[model samples]
Target: MLRRSPHHRWTLVSRVMVGVLSLLALGGIVVAFAAFAYGRSAARQAFDPLLVGAAQDIAESISIGDEGPVIDLPVSAFGLLSLAPEDRIFYAIHGPDGALLTGYDGIPAALDTVQPRFRDWTLQDDAARFVTVSRLFSERAYAGRIYVTVGQTTRARRAMALDLTRRALFVTTFGGIALIVSALIIIRSAMRPLEVLTRDLAQRDPYDLTPMQADGPQEVRVLVGALNRFMGRLDRQVGAMKNLISDTAHQLRTPVAAIRAQAELALEDDAPRRLPRLERLVWRTRSLGRLLDQMLSRALVIHRIDNAAPTAIDLRDIALTVLDSRDHELLAPGKDVQLRIGEDAVVVLADEISLTEAVRNMLVNALRHGATPVVIGVSPTPTGSAIWVQDSGDGPPDAVRATLGQRFERSAASKGNSAGLGLSIVRAVAQAFGGEMTMATVQGGFRVSLTLPHHGAGQSQ
Candidate 1:
């Protein structure tokens, strides 16, 4: 079974989506980090201001209140700490005499630094619950020095940290979800043009070699141009096939009619009395057979060229066979056809069957159309190998030499008698084998050479 043909396509939306989502995800992460940083800074700002005020209040009242060397505070002083959620708040103030002045009397005084104004530290309660804070107040707040320490339960701080984390996570997830959805939609829309091109190709008839009209992006335009080139080649091949059919049909009519007429004439017993007509009919049949064979060979050549047939064979053997096959036309004729070698045996990698056929065809043309002592030379060159056939008499007419490798081309004088595919076949064979056939004017006549790939193996003759 044959594999299905692909109409390749591409899309802009996929590229766009990839870029957009990548950038947005990155931006969202940065924003989340920035927000968390700001919140942490703001919490420190709020905590420090409140703690400093409480310390100042205790410092100012340290001179005396109801009792000696006491700092007085309202009944709602502890409620200031209770403003935060489900937290244990503790405060301590000690006079310069080293006696507790306010807040918890049983709580030991924390080791407070004199210089560090506000920092973070941890302390354990009687319940072994730890509270963390770092704060200090100087003697500038009152007449006597007072040590005041303030901290809240860690459970509340833990809850606040959890809340901030949840908010950051929510923003990241929401941003990611939004970006993903937007990316999918944009990608689809951008690629829709390619999908349209695909549908256009899918609806086409397989045999239709019509050019595409869809105008996509620039790279897509290049792809369309390539498709157009393929379509052009296909169109030319179809046209060639049509021309072949027409030519074959026209050529067949005469021979088929002549054979029918011959059979009809022979039906009468008096046919031998009409020997002239029978002889003419036999000659016509022979010419028709030769023409048909040439026509078939031409078709095969065209087919092989269009499909790129492999052509690797030994050229040395093909050269020998060609000389052997047409010995009578070459050596036995008054004209001599000879191969002069710079080397005895030059082997080549080529299509041997086609090469031999080309040689035989060239020699046949030389004998019938040119003079004696035609040289058929085989030699290897630095680049490739070559076969040169130079006839003694005047070479092919100017028109034949001019269109040497063209199909159905011939010299005007030889048009009626020659099939005109010999040189064409040679060229086609060369092309199929990834080589070239060329004609050049030599010292006395013209030379036809088929240059093919050399295998670099030979001996000096």
Candidate 2:
């Protein structure tokens, strides 16, 4: 069963858009608050000075007459207040004895301060702002200070503040929209390269395992490079599979035909001649079985090398494993097969199973093709760690040595029984693990070794 992803997947574009919109919404709220405060302050600065000027003009119009203090209620002062034509005006004068001398009778009294003062109050049942001023007279009837209070309704002041706020909100709304549009455009443009890459991969042939073009931004190029490397490994695995199928079909045909032919001849022959023919038929069947087993083993080694991760392994362990299996005693019963390894470890990084198979094949090849007293050992050399099988005889000739590791290239001694796949399996394992298979004429024998790079400590070949 296929597993579903736990998270709700979102496209890259959707994620970027959501992030941009969230930021802009928060910024818009803060900007709206700032604009409202600025509007209120601007209205106050523009109109407060005018209110003070009108109050001062009204103070200059006060005088002492025969009836005590009086006020002319200057037209110039009224004209100055007319700047807000939609607002109502109120004014009042007080005698030195605090009696209402002229103008509106119900105006709120000013505070007892000498400096001009402004205050808020209710006038004619509506909210209003007022300014108060004082003057002193030395006339006979009125020799004390006089006060003049002027006020106006707040309808026009509120309208002005609201107007300024509205204009600011208009500009901010359009600017936020423009920013959102630009962010979307930029995000789509950035994602174009990935879209193109997806399209190319979707349309390519199924069998095509070619490397992709690494283009666009640095991040996109990195993704393409990783994909290319993965495809390269897959291609090698496919090639190996194809080779196995082709080799199986080509190698099995002649041996099967010969075996069938021998069996038919045995069935027709007399009892006296039948024994030899039956023996030959049995020999052919055994040779075919060995060939099939080696072919399958080689295929398995290739598969594991691609899929298995490598680890540090002691070469001595591989040598011991082969010696302990004692399959050699079956092939060459009573033949001398010596295990020669030192106490020190000879370690290399490799797949343990693949290395063991390769070493086992080396021992088998040596036992089959060389003289008696075959010796298997793990030793440290100047170049690398070596697992070797040696026999007390001269190695193959120079011409045969050149072609030794190729599959099905049998030497003359085996005649026709040998499958000639052992050395090829050793070569495959060696090359797969970044190692090499070497054959040399040693002092007392022929030697075949699979030498691999040292993992932790250096060992020479």
Candidate 3:
């Protein structure tokens, strides 16, 4: 059964827009609330002073006459209260003894003090605001105090507050929407570089491993750098694999053709002559197998050189291990492979498997081309460590020796049976470890040495 992968919910731009819009919306709501409160307070401040002026005018109309306190409500007082025409106006006058002298008896005086007071109350079924003013009448007939009260329904004040709040709401709504839209546009513009980068990567060829340009914001540049490094590693690995396939096909062609020819000859011969032909066929098959083995060995050495991390390896131990392996006996039968080690430890930085394969190839090559009694030795050089294979025969000519480590280039002494990949593998291993391979004629015999840099001598440590 197949299962589907989960899809991504949001992209970077969407996330940024959502976050910014959310904050703006929250801020807009807070601003709206503050506007409502400020509008209500400003409405009260503006209208309350008008209500006080009306009450004072009504107080000034009271007089201490012979009968008692005479009150005549002024038309100017009513005119002032009528400024807010939508509101209902009411007024009342009271004697010092709390009796209603004139005007409406329904209206209540809030305080008995001599100072004016303003308050809010319910009149009939409507909300109302009122102001009360008290005055002293000190005449012969009347020597006491009088109270006057004025009130108006709150329709005008509520209308003004509503208008202010509507204006604020309109402005904030449009401004917040404009800001959110502007933010989205800016976000899209900022992400243009990433979009271009994505398009470039998607359109690239599968084998392309070129590094991308690190041009963008700092965070994006970091991502591009990592991608470039990864592509570099992939390029090297792919190149190694391609070389492996090409070399295998090229080197196996000759041996495979020889095997096929010998097989045909064996099949055409009679029983008495077939045996010799079959023997040759078997030998050719074994040679083909050896060629394949060397080709694979060389490919593995190159792969390890490119990919494997190096560790401190003692060259003396590698030499001894190569000498003790069964390959030595199989390649040089009835001959003991000698190993010589110096007094000091000879350590170099290298991959152990690659180094061992290189040494083994050198041993096999010496036994195949030179005489018996091959000596594998390790010693500390002035710069690093040296391991060499010395045998009892003169080496190839100087011309062949100069090109010894090249792939599939064998000496005149090496017949067609030789794969010619042995020294090439050795040289690759030496170069991987910051070393070099040298060929020399010494003691009337051939010597091939791999000189490696010391582990603790440089940055390789």
Candidate 4:
């Protein structure tokens, strides 16, 4: 035997149909109750007046006879009751002394008041309605009251009520069906947008990550906009991955070949000549290692820029953290490196790791290419926050400055000694955080600054 699934999934149309049908059923039940009540009230009102009129006619026909009272039943009274031919009727007359004068004797005489009254009763083992009226008499022979009672079986009233209910139910059933059909059409029309979106997504090329047109009802438009944003993020991540692979292959090949050749030469050289070849081999290996490390760092920085949530960071803290790492001392031993930051906090909204990597690259570039007495500092600019690395020498010549941030673009002064990715990393971080990198000749030295938009203290992005 096949097992049933634990979870049941319903389509939008199915849910809407179920909802519409449920509402209609509930409404039908309420309408049925109301129609039944209205029918009963109307039936009673229609027949009660006839019973009263017949009782009054019988009471008026009574007169004082020679002995006491005589009842002369009116033919018109019977004619009025004949309107409901399917019903059984009964009547009775009584003298002032409580004697049955004429007609059926079982209907009791009224003892409450001298007024006409109506009630429900059973006669001849069948349900019935009754009306009693008292007639006053003043004559020479008899001077008292005569009572008239009239009743009828309720068969016709019940039939009339049932007929009315049936007619109302007939109208309601057809009307409810029509309303359900119209609701289905409206629901299907409303769901068309989702159908179109599903088809568009299904037919799209896997590589196509462009934003979709967001045109529909407000809810559908919101869904489309969210889908577009998700695709955009995915596209950026894929592009970053592609760039990492290509940069790794293109930048590492020449150095890797050079390292292999130097290694082979060192192994073949005589002991007298082996020390210099070994030194060159070690230097080439270190340069290749540094190049690989910087390439990976650039890739990671790009990834984090898109994926990392930003927090409010004080620029002074970043500068202090870089100084505390002691990496600069290793990069350039015996070089003058100092920090110039005030006590006040200068904050920006950025990824901490990515920002630190950018700042570290700035210091590395200053140590490798610029003169001694290097300084790193943080300060508040009029428009934003600034973290800069300045050295005692004039910055790269104007011709080299234009191509400075491009990957692997070396200057003539470096003479093939630098990897050329430091400024590129700084530029990427600056642009990613809605900021800019500037190279300027300050009063003391050449300065490379990464200026970021100011974030309010304690605020996060």
**TM-score, structure 4 vs. true:** 0.80
Q: Which 10 successive residues of model 3 have the least lDDT summed?
A: 452-461
Q: Give lDDT for model 2.
A: 0.85
Using lDDT as the measure, name the better of candidate 1 and candidate 2.
2
lDDT of 3 at 126: 89
* Candidate 2 ranges beyond 4 A from true positions: 1-11, 29-185, 381-383, 456-461
The deviation in Å at residue 290 for candidate 2 is 1.7
Report the C-alpha lDDT of model 4 over 1-461, residue by residue, as the tens digit: 97766435678788889989999999999988888888888898999899889999988888777886767888999787898999998988877777888878777557454878887887788999988889888887888888888998889898888888888989999999899889999999999999899999999999999999998899999999999988987898898788788988888888889988988898898999889988888888888887887888888898898899989899899999999999988889999999998877788999999999999999998999999899999887776899999999998889889999988888988766678888898999999899999999999999999999988763222
Positional deviation of residue 137's Cα in model 3 after best superposition, in angstroms: 28
TM-score of 1: 0.56
lDDT of 3 by residue, 1-461 (tens): 96654435678898898799889888888877888788879988888888888888878877766777777778888886687988899888888888888877778686477777887888898899888888887877787778888889989888888788889989988998898889888889899989988998999998889999999998789989999988976886787688778977887787788889889988898999999988988888888888889888987887787778888888888987886677877766797577788767778889999999998989988988988678898876676678999988888888788888988888887776578889999998888789999899998478899999877643122
| Candidate 2 RMSD computed on C-alpha atoms after optimal superposition onto the true structure | 6.2
Report lDDT (CA) for all predictions.
0.65, 0.85, 0.84, 0.88
Give all TM-scores, in the order shown. 0.56, 0.71, 0.58, 0.80
Tens digits of lDDT, candidate 2, 1-461: 97767445878898888889888888878877777788767866776677778877888977767875566777898786798999998888776677887778888757364787788888778989888888877866658777788888888788887787788778887998998899899889999999999999999999999999999999999999999988977887897788788888899999999999999999999999999999999999989998988888888888888889999999888888989999998988888999999988788989989888888888888888889899998888777888999999898898899899898889988777678888898999899888899999989999999998888763433
Give me the overall lDDT of model 4.
0.88
Task: List the candidate numbers ranked by lDDT, top first.
Answer: 4, 2, 3, 1
